[model samples]
Target: CPPIGLESHRIDDDQLLASSMLRHGLGAQRGRLNMQAGTNEDDFYDGAWCAEDDGRTHWLEGDTRRTTKFTGVITQGRDSQIHEDFVTSFYVGFSNDSQNWVMYSNGYEEMMFYGNVDKDTPVLTEFPEPVVARYIRIYPQRWNGSLCLRLEVLGCPLSSVSSYYAQQNEVTSTDNLDFRHHSYKDMRQLMKVVNEECPTITRIYNIGKSSRGLKIYAMEVSDNPGEHETGEPEFRYTAGLHGNEVLGRELLLLLLQFLCREFQAGNSRVRNLVTQTRIHIVPSLNPDGYELASQAGSELGNWALGHWTEEGYDLFENFPDLASALWAAEERKLVPHKFPNHHIPIPEHYLAEDTMVAVETRAIMAWMDKNPFVLGANLQGGEKLVSYPFDTARPLSETLAAAPRPPDYEDDHPELQETPDHAIFRWLAISYASAHLTMSETFRGGCHTQDVTDAMGIVQGAKWHPRAGSMNDFSYLHTNCLELSVYLGCDKFPHESELQQEWENNKESLLTFMEQVHRGIKGLVRDQQGEPIANATIVVGGINHNVKTAASGDYWRILNPGEYRVWARAEGYNPSVKTCSVFYDIGATQCDFVLARSNWKRIREIMAMNGNRPI
Candidate 1:
């Protein structure tokens, strides 16, 4: 016949015959019956099978044992061939024991292949119902001389393959430039992104809503979640209190982004602050006002007065009750209907009420009540200056005398009495005056109180209401927290171009102002035993500054630098006095006393007793 002979050969029975023929003439000349030509027949051989006398035994390695899954090399040997005439087919048999095997070929048609092949072919099989295959036989029938067989079985389970792909696609996306702007929506979105990215360090809270119904968000940036629960000293920075002051709003947003970035990069100072102290930020307090102001020019069709009405009264004037009245009067004279439309008496609308008297004030008050360690500043603008407390009117208890003494009519002095409650208003007035300076640029007017008042009246359409419900007053009176009102001045409404210059001019002064406030609070006088001594007298003789401590042993005094006598006295002891010299920029002083008993009175009593005793 041709090289395609041997139609009568039985593949299973001809093993020895083929080996013998391969070594002899017919097999040697044809290279052992051209076993490479029958390499494709190996696909039917079940490569893992070992032939015994009666049957073939097949096994799989790995997790496939005792399971009907035949898992090993599925693609058989590397060098097997298939003839074009005889189609290649494979049959797999399963058995629970070493004997009595059953063919699974009928139900799993996918387990068989019928195509001409060259090279070792995989015995394709379906993962049907799992069977414990103690033996599997792969039979190839009706193969030409060129056909050969081999088999490969898989040993890995299906679930592991699925799991690998499942995990391969789950990487989080990272894009830079994510938080470069101050858009409210962008900020909110960035916060969400940050929270997701850094779950261990960040949390956000919705404080309330702005007047325009937009969500007013306050982000509590901290490392420890417990910090919020502990009610620790919280530093709060609120921007855009006046809707038109847009730079602060933008700056606050940028600051938040910067903080988040720096924190993620392992900045120690920021990280420590976020963990140790609660940092609260209200980026835009007056969102409604901002939106209105930002859209003013476009909507109103006027660049000179943008959305801001020419008659719109300044919010800074709405401080004390008198100032509020002045503001209301000015508003009535300017845009009578437009002025008070948004000005409500509720605490949130007034800084004094908001910080010291109103509901919003209660929010901060509650915070202060819990955290006595707070130190903060409220930022405002109109004049580039810092104004401390006692802005409204001094409390009635301050006096000029430095020591405890009975009133003398020759001095024309007012009623002076030492009580448990003494006014430190004078102390506050002098301290703030000495520490900070109001802007010196005068508005082309004479330097007289009346002249200034009249000029303000002409511009504002009312007498200057200098004092009102102010936050600084409340901070000094109600809490131990050190707070200051920072008035960042601009010659006119701040424009985008001037913001950098304005900040450059005021940054150092602002920090120094804060430091002074810090030192003043931190360096209060204590007694010799380190206990805060009550009623300790501090006299700044340069400006004739004099004040007494309260029951709490807290005193605040401000005066020019000079040589002065400071004294402390108690009822049972001789008074103590000291002469000391002070210098400018010396923020505070600590002087304590240990007094001895007065001997003059006791000696006089002894002399009187001797006279009575007839000595």
Candidate 2:
């Protein structure tokens, strides 16, 4: 359920006017008010001592009741004061209808008060479990001659917040409007709607909650469970882990709506994938950051609100170990020299690292652990690059490395043959570059290949560290998942026009990239009989062409096409080697092999008779 707001009423007098004036001084603007005073009155006031009129009691004669709408759960400030007079008491009231009101705070009426007209003071208030309220009012009792009251309301209005993002301006009108842009609230609404509309394949689960106590939700989309007897290989896409990088969230939402509608309409490809592969998505991993970023412009407030310490300058570089250490030793202690640190007084509250890891990263890691899917991609922005693991410089942890290499007939271990393949990763890199690069051939010149050993090392050494507990790294290293982290662009939020155009231009390519990854994974391993071979060694020559097969006889490697020899060898058989021709097919192919046994006895007799056998 969504968090609700609280409403309060105040008696108008000199003190109230003074308090309103003071609020205006503190940047609080006057809101719309409802009054019951007679029309066209110059100044509607009953002398000093006003009458306790019936309608006046609730609606206040000539008195205006202004309302402030907050989107989420509201909390008061701590420095709150009521003019020159000290606040004696304050009580919060709630009502389903504007007409009826009742005291809703715990029996303890006085939440907090101040001695002087100084800073705003926050009052402790708690909403009922699963808060769902339309109206909340606060009544403050004054200590001086006239009772002037004011209640500082906190939290955003869920209704307005949700509706504000219902319809977003697209890059172009031709793009489907049903692919609605979404915010945090829209994500929640969309999930509920999706689940209700397509119960068979749509499911909404709580991965965890954000630092601000907002539920971190995940949606799983697939065909009816039994469509594929063995829960099909899964593919995952996640977005919004960094609050400011919101385009992915919007794209994710659009994707979900698109797939759901297509599936319901019996779109063959959509149906096939949904029924054949489980697709799980975490649209917004950092809801708190999302809301803060949405409220505080993309760049300004995002880095300031979480467990971040550094102020003023951007904290984007804080994720890496070196930056974190530098920040802790220097920037963390240095307050923003330009502005007061009142907004983010505590370093932990501002840095966001502690909260981001505990809340967002943990949930994502847990989910990856359970699914162990074949393919996963984490979408981020600010770089036009696609990266793969081991993004952190760790050695490849897959069991294929330990399995036997192909009977090299030259390299050391001929007895232990049939390891998994590594070409899938290389192919994954080339295919990705082919599909997404603005300059089709440019990526080929740069660092682009899925060879974890060499490719990831260069990526890390180049300071690309999307690897710290990254969902992609977690999926690949910890499970049998082939993962990649995709950077949409090299700059922060390109112009709306450019972003829309880019997405339009790349939609087909993006889909193609996914399809290629799927196909690449499927073609990694097979036996001479064309049967899927488990634990087979598939090697491609390079700095080091080595890979082992999985229990399913599947091996994934990424590589570029050139003259390369592929060999398959097993014990009790003559090693088979072939100069295989492999290239980017833009489609699928079958690469299987067979091995013949070596006749040692016949060779021995021939060698003894001819005296030509070399021991």
Candidate 3:
């Protein structure tokens, strides 16, 4: 029940306003003096490099006697940090601790706001409503250059801050901070609480270390945590790949709590998911970024902050692009492929295929290898839609001939390379958006190309903004795992108060999305002798991805209700391909395969031809 919601502003970029500002006495303070609530990057100022909004501007015009409304205000001057030109494009906003005033669903708190797009004009912000609050907060947001500015809040006080402290105390209480952002350190403490409370269904473990050697932690939630369960499908909800995107990390921690609480309370739906599936949640994959991001929002806004990993590499970019030409040159021949039939090397320079992946990415890759995750959603921020692969089809290589590439399945255009599972991906994506309260509707503003209606709130990754070397693509292609880049919203890091609402917004969708892991084909891969195939590759036809069987000879691949041709193969064994029919709304279909040794024929003759074929 949040988003005290107020939006829209008027801008007055009149340069003559500078001399007029001397008539009013107000000099804005340098960065915040205290690390107050709502003082972080997520709440007010975002970085200039982003396509999204940025910083705050606060000003106080000459003191007013009576409660009055503000009509107009002017910019005072520029402060710290600057572009080479000493000019920048920016949108300024206002905020104050005096009263809640209004908050946007996007999570920004402000009264009236405005800014300029060029260095030439002095900024003048006019308001529709009177500045009634004794204190006026004017901050800059969504700028392309420069940092820090001095502005005037042109208004009279129609409001008072007499009860500000009391209200602040109430809002800052532990109960109101339910979905508060958790630091890497806070996560550890949370994991300890989870282990203490749900000793049986949940377990906390360290998967590996990131670049800064921060222990990348995971929360295992299942009836049998940390242990392999035969025939049970495994699902993962990975968040915080971009440390600056904090909501996913918070939601995951809450989700962990949801499972433990609901399961203990005998909630049937949760009981089933927990009992029949193994779920893993890595809260903060980039702890170093999380820390930097945390600082970016607080009074410590001067810190060198960002979403990249500690070593300065985008975590998502660090993964190996198995579809790239570099992979073809180095490891393609070694790793067999099953789909698109033609094995064309993804152009060598495609993304960072040749460069070493960041330590964090490698850790995730290793952890993924140890489990059979049928379905997953990589929680990220920056948009408010569910996106599916193939994030990219061809490399950004100069050698890439202009002739429409291999994915010419549609228009003879290479840019339209849809994944083999495009149909199913679309369905699953719609399922999430439809379940969302507002996401199903259309949004038209900054960032995306069009209002999201034709495809609903779901989008194709490459189509929206063709990115390279994404975690979703790598996981889907190499592991045969299905992962959706779930963009929670535009604010990568929102105020803590907005986090709970975010969790609620995505909760139902989250559950329904995870349930998708149970819609495809799942079973065991055993040898003719009935022995387990510890790590056999299971590839679903038409889909370029594969799911490997676990140590218990079990594998799971979730797909939308449909028929699929499944092929299971292991080292030194004859391959087995079978057809399986999956129905709508039905549970997973079980299809087991028995592979015979490639040398079984020679052995059969050596042992005096067997009387019958081994079952």
Best model number under TM-score: 3
Q: lDDT of candidate 1 vs native? A: 0.40
Q: Candidate 3 at 333: error in angstroms?
A: 12
The lDDT, on a scale of 0 to 1, for candidate 2 is 0.44
Ranking, TM-score, top scorer first = 3, 2, 1
The candidate with the higher lDDT, 1 or 3, is 3
Query: Lowest summed lDDT over 10 consecutive residues: which window, candidate 1?
Result: 1-10
Question: All models: lDDT?
Answer: 0.40, 0.44, 0.61
Q: Is candidate 1 or candidate 2 better by TM-score?
A: 2
The superposed Cα distance between candidate 2 and the true structure at residue 134, in angstroms, equals: 46
Count of clashes, each model: 36, 59, 31
Q: Where is model 3 poorest over a 10-residue stretch in terms of lDDT?
A: 7-16
* lDDT by residue for model 1 (279-317), tens: 666666555556655653211211122112122423333
- TM-score pick, better of 2 and 3: 3
Off by over 4 Å in 1: 1-202, 225-232, 263-276, 297-373, 394-465, 491-493, 497-615
In terms of lDDT, which candidate is stronger, 2 or 3? Answer: 3
TM-scores of the candidates are 0.37, 0.45, 0.68
Tell me the spans in candidate 2 whose CA falls farther than 4 Å from its real position.
Answer: 1-173, 178-181, 225-231, 265-269, 298-357, 393-471, 490-502, 521-615
